[model samples]
Target: MKKIIFSLLVLAASFSANAQVDRSTMPKAGPAPEINLSKPQSFELKNGLKVIVVENHKLPRVAYTLTLDNPPIQEGDKTGAATLSGALLGKGSTSISKDAYNEEVDFMGARINFGSQYAAASGLTQYSDRILELLADAAINPNFTEEEFNKEKALLIDNLKTNEKSVSAAASTASRALLYGKDHPKGEFETPAGLENVTLADAKAFYNKAFIPNNAYLVVVGDVDFKNIKKIVTSNFKDWKKGSALPAAFTTPKNVVSTEIDFIDMPNAVQSEVIVENLVSLKMSDPDYFPVLMANQILGGGGEGRLFLNLREDKGYTYGAYSSIGNDKYGMTSFSASASVRNMVTDSSVVAFLEEIDRIRETPVSEKDLKNAKAKYVGSFVRSLEQPATVARFALNIETENLPEDFYQNYLSKINAVTIADVQRVAKKYFLSDNSRIVIAGKGSEVLSNLENVSFKGKTIPVKFYDKEGNAVEKPKYEVALPEGVTKQTVLNNYLEAIGGKDKVAALESLLMVGEGSVQGTPLKLTMKKTNKEQFVQMIEVMGNVMSKQVLNGDTAVITAQGQTVTPTPEQLKDLKAESAIVAELNMLDDETIKLEKIEKVDGKNAYVLALNEKKKAFYDTESGLKIKEETTQEMQGQTFVQTVLFGDYKEVKGVQFPTKLSQSMGPQNIEFTFSEVKVNEGVTEADFK
Candidate 1:
């Protein structure tokens, strides 16, 4: 009873003390907190491999990163040799079988991977010794067999092919290739031709010459003693011989004299990829580093940045906008602000980007912007210090970038010291908007005319054309005249004739299609069923779990997703009922609103574009008379999205031709579904619509 009375008295006194303090006055910002960061221990081996170790006992695990800090490799025709060679490593060593090596690593729940010039391994502290030994064996004595080389080469080429039609990929390559000439190491990109030229001999030669111990650093972090790690590293790498000195210098790339637009025409692009880039020479040790970092943060760092607010939030041109500046110790790097925007606003987005860049350069950032940016950096730095690997990385960076001993130690203080003046100064020095290369990769038919006359502040920017491979080319002839005497009804009749006869199509009672594809690496299956009775069912599954289901029966339409069922409005149900036919074109043929808009290219083939009302369009091949593509405009959350579907690989089933391949694009995602089964008048019943 006495203790309870004492506790109540203390609580009452705390409340009385709080009531006496002033609550109206705002508090001043405090100084940067002093970070109790632990420094990593370092040692050098006789073979010139430097090791840095950071001990953290909080987690009974360890990680080692072997980075070859060498100059960028300029591979002419064999541009992908280093990447392929890196992938070839860690498959198996001369000492262990491939299956055995992978099985053991998996059993230990560890990850071991290698790249062109780096290797990483992590496991529990108890298995650290074996992990390091396996890593060393794989790195030093890689099994470079012909079969493995073929597999890796094919995989690399496959990746290149996959990105062949990607607008963003084309923009990225064109930007770097223009910033730094294609001959420079920083500008070189992998091509299928390059990968095909890369023989096993080239990979072996690159590995022998580039993977040297002289310029490599092995960073070890997590639970381990410095001395024990040093001993084990020494014993494992002592026998590895050091090669000749690596290349240390290269020519720095220069920026353009004035801002200009470089446009690449891709007829299939649904949106435009805009990139404004300029070459700048900056390094980690430079005094302007911290200020440039802050400037980028305030300019286009994240969703809060000015570019995002203007382009996405205000103008509604894109999903997001961002900017980044690269710092390189070897050669000059680039500063780029970029976005993927609707094709109609490609030119407008470019101008908005330039305005933001110029605004940051001309005006001094407000004190609030400065404080917020600093707070973000300070918070991020303090949180990163909690990770033991951060300590090891800091040590390695200091050694590699020639930074001072206490560079990361005073990181937060330096960030906090940056004033608005510093941000404006760096902004003017680095953000070279006047001498920028505006790269726009998109459909020439849609955006070319607008981009040709794009003006910022009454000064029109000249537009230059280039092919997707970065080669200068003449302005493409986008207009292909429609053939003589072709009307909407003729096109519709041709499509009906292309896919089975009208009589056969009308006689069909039911149809079912089963297709398989993946979205972001998740297995997706689509099952669609339709009956002549105007009942339709569509189901989408991810990994065999139904993600969404939609059913249209008679005049009612319902959609089920995430345990919620929603009924479509009368207008939406009318549109859904129009698609209840087995072949939609059969109904479209009777609609008077459908008209032939024009003839445009769809995947390099001339196709007839039919405007199916204001919200949808369909493209039909002029020669084959088959419906090749469909486009629809949808509104969700006050934002508009254009979804596209490309149909190809037609095969005959039940005496009617059906599309076997379907590629769909919704916003930023593209899924290619390959049909495995097509049943006509079978595999579907009235109960399926339930």
Candidate 2:
């Protein structure tokens, strides 16, 4: 009896211990610390090197950041020159080739990066004590080899070319130009010609003028011993002479008094790109910054924010939408939101965005909204401590912005202090729906026609198309012609088999394939995933790296890439539907006579041509026949390339025929293959497309 009683007692104790809740019936955390912050310790070396040290011995590693405040490179002509110069600096240093430098850095587990901004040239490094010397080498001994410079320059040009094709980039680029005059530093655009002029001499000159230790500040944080770090820096950078201090100059233009409707034409865009931007005044240290930040959070910050709740959850007009205030050095802030809506609803969506903006400015936020926003901001701020790098970055921002060291410590209190009156005042003052610069980049013909003939402050504004150089751009010619004799059915079958096998492909409700290849002598990879309703591609090497396209009800098409989500242009959407219908028709083909036409030179290469037609004469219809086109091309990478495939083949799998092979030329040398190991339709779920 005693043994049984003791076992019951032990089990109860175990359950009680396991069921303990950390927060249940516990006292709430007290208000944050309100302690005064100590000023940063600083000293200047004889050669003009400025050192700012913040000692925090909590972690056993150090982070070093060097910044050279330089003037914006020659105003309007070559905006990206400084950026290109910074990139070229780290390609090769005095004692190392580009490849050798990359290998050494990889082996040492060290990282180095340089970039040019409006006011500074910055380089950052973080590593243990053992790799500090290598970091110094990278900073002080940049060789700027001609070979590497040329290679990097070409790559930059290619990147710019790729950006031009992106809708989001085009919208942002156009918006900046409209908000700030094209000549302003904040609004300047980088052109291909500007990149073309960045010679090795130009990079060397920029480096010589800006990379002076006397005109630079070195901030060292973490487990760094000041004495040891100073010694290492002196040894690596002592001989560097001081250069002339560049003048500090920047101008933020007054907001335009009238609404401007700028349009960028993408002929076959599946969705419209929209951005409504207007200048706002909220400096980093201003009393209104805290309140405004909280207000924007409530207005349209994230999934739970106002914009998302209205546009996505309630109306289903878009997948997602949000707004933000980008606080910069010059106190420039703009609230913007984007969404991809059907062509018919394009105008209605714009009306909704504007209506929400106006509503916020006119009415005070509810107590519930204010509380949720504050809680989210405070909670997220506390959670950010889980990442060391993020903590360091926040610390750096605090220092750079000249905010109090304990600024973040009292973050919640400051946000909580903001009242509904404060929210209304900032919104009224900053949110200018009347004069906002509304820019749309998409199939202008279809979208513009549907929009209520909008006038900027009552003046009619005409839509215009401009190239990257801000000059009028012509419409692109899209010519896709299939070789004669190939029937649509045969082409469809070949394409299906090439991907995998029809049975397996059809069974798969969704599929994802990743491929690696070479471009301009560099290895690159891309990942693509597809389902009946949507497709997504991550081209690992590009800006706006996440791109997605989707189909709805087998008729409408939508695409989200870069920062913009758009539905296809009217014509493009029409084409998309036609393509879908063709695919369906191809799926029905059983047996067809396919013939390989004679080899023909295409794009400077001999390509094998194939044709397909219905086998039975009774089923043949010249008007209804669909053509199939296939070509083979050689791909190269570095010193190696393959005279591989760009061919389409059909094979049977699970009693269905499908295309299984897809090959494309990557550059001068490499060919990429996208192979599927298994594709089975076991049962596709609706959530898979989402």
Candidate 3:
């Protein structure tokens, strides 16, 4: 009772003191906290493999990271050899079956991963010895069987096929190719032909040549004795042979002479991928490193950045905009600002990016931005120090990047010391606005015209066309001359005849489609039902749970997503009513607002383009007379969304042909649905539209 009374008195006194103090001015920030960095113990093996170990007994866990610091090698034709070899590693060693190896790792609750030049393993500290032994065995004696090689190669091919249609992937490839010559190691992307050229022998050769230990560093962190770890590493890796020394000299690629737009055409794209980049020679050891870091942070490092504010929050052109500056010890890296934006605003987005970048380069950042950026960095850096692996990484960077031992120790101080003038100076030097490549991978038909006319500061940014592979090409011809006597009604009639007959389509009273697809690997079931009486229902289910549902019943249209149901706005209701018909093509034939535009390529085949409205377009195969694709743009909650649907693999249902495969894109995610069952005038009932 006495202690409680004393504590209450103390609390009352503290409040009285606080009430007496001034509350008008903001308090000054205190000095940066000191970081307690653990000095890693090190040893070297006979095979020239250096091992560094950091001890932390706070947690009963251990991690080992082995990195081969080899110089970059240009794999001209066999570009995928290294990648395939990396995937083949960590599967099993000579003495262990793949299944047995994986089972043991899983049993121990450990993670083991391998790449072309690196291997990492971690688990409970009690399993440290076995984990290290397994890591060394897998890294040194990988079982590169013919079966595994074939499987990995086929999977790689499938991945490349997916990337071929990805606008962001194309932009990344084009940006690298434009910034660095395609022959350079930094720029060469693996192609399907390259994958075909890579034989099993090439993968083995790359493994033998590149995965050496002479220039390697193994960082062991977590609860472990340095002496025991050194002995274990020596015992396991002693037999591994060192390869020949890598060549130190390599040529760095140069940026373009002047700012120009390098546009790659992706006709199926609903949005544009834009990148503004320039080459820089910044390294961690450079004096401008801290300044450049602060500059990029103020420009576009996170949600509070100028780019994100201007492009996403203010302009609403994209969901997010970001920039990154790379630091390479090899004297070549890029400073890039990038965004995925709406197709129609691609040109405006580019201008916005340039403006923000130029603004940062020309003007000094405010003191508030500098202080906030420093605080962000200090907080993140301090928080990261809680991980034992971060200490190991810092020690490794000091060794690999040739930095002073006290570099990370003085990190916060350096960031704090960076003045606003220093940020502007470094930004001006590294963020080259005058000589940069604006690489845009987008729909040329929608963006090229406005992009050609985009000018900044009295200078036009010339638009140069390129294929997806970054090869220079002639300007794309978006439209072709229509064949003689082709009209909107003629195309509609051809589609109606191609599906079945106009009479059969009109005779169809109701339709139901049940399909399955996956989003981010989660399986989903889609059910769509429609009737000629202007009643429709669409539902998506995951694991027997309804994810979303939409219903159009006579005069009432409503949507329910994740248990929240809302009535559609008048405009949305009009659009839903337009799409509610069972036979949309029959209604479209009579709708005078829909107009036949021109012929363009859809999936490498000619298709007649039709403008259904200002926000919607439809594509029909010119030869097959089938509706192939449809694109719609909508505005919801002050944000614009572009959704695309691709129809294919038509199968007969009763007397009319219906699409069995549907590929739909919701923003950046693509879901391909395969219809397993279709019922015509049999399954759908009036109650389904409730």
* lDDT, candidate 2, 553-659, per-residue tens: 34545656556778778865644543343134333465345454343333223333443332111112122122222222222221111122342344444454433
**TM-scores for every candidate against the unseen true structure:** 0.95, 0.64, 0.93
Best by TM-score: 1
Error of 2 at 320 (Å): 1.6
For model 1, residues 546-584, the per-residue Cα lDDT tens digits are 899889999878988877899988877877776777898
Better of 2 and 3 by TM-score: 3
What lDDT would each prediction earn against the true structure?
A: 0.89, 0.59, 0.90
| Model 3 spans with C-alpha error above 4 angstroms | 1-30, 553-558, 568-580, 681-690
RMSD each, Å: 2.7, 13.7, 3.2
lDDT of 1 at 479: 80
Between prediction 2 and prediction 3, which has the larger lDDT? 3
lDDT minimum window of 10 residues, candidate 2: 615-624
Report the C-alpha lDDT of model 3 over 234-298, residue by residue, as the tens digit. Answer: 99999999899777555689988999999999988989999999999988998999999899998
Candidate 2 yields a Cα-based lDDT of 0.59
- Looking at candidate 2, what is the lDDT of residue 77? 66
Better of 1 and 3 by lDDT: 3
